[model samples]
Target chain A: MVEVATILLMGVFAALAIHSNVLRLAIIYLAVFSLLAAFLYLLYAAPELAIAEAVIGSGLVTLLYLAALKRNRVYTIGVVNEQQRDHLSDSYISHVERSKALREIRQFFLLREFEVQIVFVSSALDEALNDPAYDLIVAEDGEGFAAFTDDESYAMLELEMMVQMHGSGSAIRFVRHSEEGVV
Target chain B: MSDTNVGSESTILRLIVGLLYPFMLLFGFYVILNGHYTPGGGFQGGSVLASLFVARYVVYPVEDTDTEVLHAIQRVFLSLILIAPTVLLFTGLVARFPHYRGLYLTTMDVLIGVQVGFGLGVAVLRFAFFQGVGKTWRL
Candidate 1:
């Protein structure tokens, strides 16, 4: 009966560890799974292995994973557009160009293994820039494109270089906001 | 991010950790010393010892570990683990000493426990200080 309970609990925690969306909760579930596995080891009369599992598996591994998660911080990019709406259908070439630019931007960050999130905003570029929530703001400016960022976003230098090289002949301008300037 | 240091700020947790800290260390050393007569041994006891620091961090999220000292202690213990048996064998102490097998095993176990304990403590301290804790998911 004890063995059966341990196996049952292990199964439950294992499933939860896989299905949970929250990383921290999933880590906790994995720890619980290790704890149940330790109990199972004890039932089989392997007390030495049980103690090792309970200590290293549940404790040390969880701490290590948390530390790694913390180190890899997220990067948010907000894309805003100011083009006036027209009844004319969008051209295929323009659509492809826009998608290609976005894809290149994403790939540039992905190659560096930075977690990148791109949020599309239909609002005015100034409103989006004033929101203060986005790490980088990309907007349609006159004949080309402009990217806005604060002084703290040193990673934007790489993005600036990527846009210059791969932006399909379109002029790309980077505007760096000072610490005391408007966000 | 704001709540990352919440554990250290809780009075109840601080009190609990303070009360249990000494007992935990006592139990860890007990396991290490009694390895020959018990199921727990060097690795298990060492893990317990490492957990003492983990518990301390829970109540006080601060980096107070001296990596230089820990590294030195770990090296010394590891050297002892390697050299002790060789010295005993060369000096014919294994044959001359009473219950030499038990003595050698216990001494090796203690050395291993100290080595593993300090090594793991250093790893935990490095992670906490350099990498930190929690996750940040953004786009």
Candidate 2:
């Protein structure tokens, strides 16, 4: 019976991991795998692990998937209802500084033909830079700087605030463009 | 009949759900209550019930779901779940000092079972419904 269950479990796990597009499904599968593992442990006379899996695997995983779903949904819905969407840059960064870097990043997105978005998480303003469907998350309480970056760009930014937020020794990915950003 | 339509799977699915969901809930309750006497307990049963909720979600849309009431019940039970063990511990100590018919074991078992079940259920649904891991959404 255990062998059969394990085989079936493996099959499901494989199916779930193969689906990468929908992150929610992947997470659900992981939770399920953990849960099944717990049950197996219980059968094998290990109640401690069973309890842990029941609590952490199923409980916590479910909570995470739901929150992400709601956040994205709410933002998308807002964009649909509001026809015109404006950029919500940080007040400190809102005013176009006419910096060589910022201009270049903007131009690169246009040139490469990759639809891009840059959001500065701030409490004062909430606007979507390019896609109104997604917002510039102005977080009152959050850890680290939740922003995208390139390898070269990350090296340039001091990332002091982010370091303080996320603790030292963490890395950020900065995207780079080979071609010059042009309108 | 001109415009009315129901999928072939609809009737069968409803029948299956109707027959199984209530039984599942009842069985889960039995597990929690008889936890001391059996291998299974509240946490196991509560999870089963939560899975039933997932089934319900599959059968119906979230707007159509009893999400509000479900969450309300979860909140109430979660508080009870947290309080159960503390209550058991204190009450057990009191009984132990008297050295009389101490019922701490029984009470603690039952209370813990219920608490654990409710906790597990809430946790599972919290994650399954997309609230994000460890990030709680208040009912």
DockQ of each: 0.29, 0.06
Poorly placed runs, candidate 1 (over 4 Å): A74-103, A106-113, A116-183, B1-8, B89-92, B131-139
Off by over 4 Å in 2: A1-32, A47-183, B1-13, B62-88, B91-106, B109-139
Q: Report, to 2 decimal places, the DockQ of model 1.
A: 0.29
lDDT of 2 by residue, B10-119 (tens): 87777787788788778766765666676565566556555665555445424334445555665776676568656655567556566532344445445555555455
How close to the true structure is residue B5 of candidate 1, measured as C-alpha lDDT? 57
Ten-residue stretch with the least lDDT total in model 1 chain A: A84-93
- Give the lowest summed-lDDT range of ten residues in model 1 chain B: B130-139
Candidate 2 residue-wise lDDT, A1-183, digit = tens: 885787688677867757654557776777777778778778889774575567456755555565455444321111111211244445535432243334443443343333334443322222332333342222121232233322344322433243345554433223232224211
DockQ top scorer? 1
How far off is residue A6 in model 2, in Å? 4.2
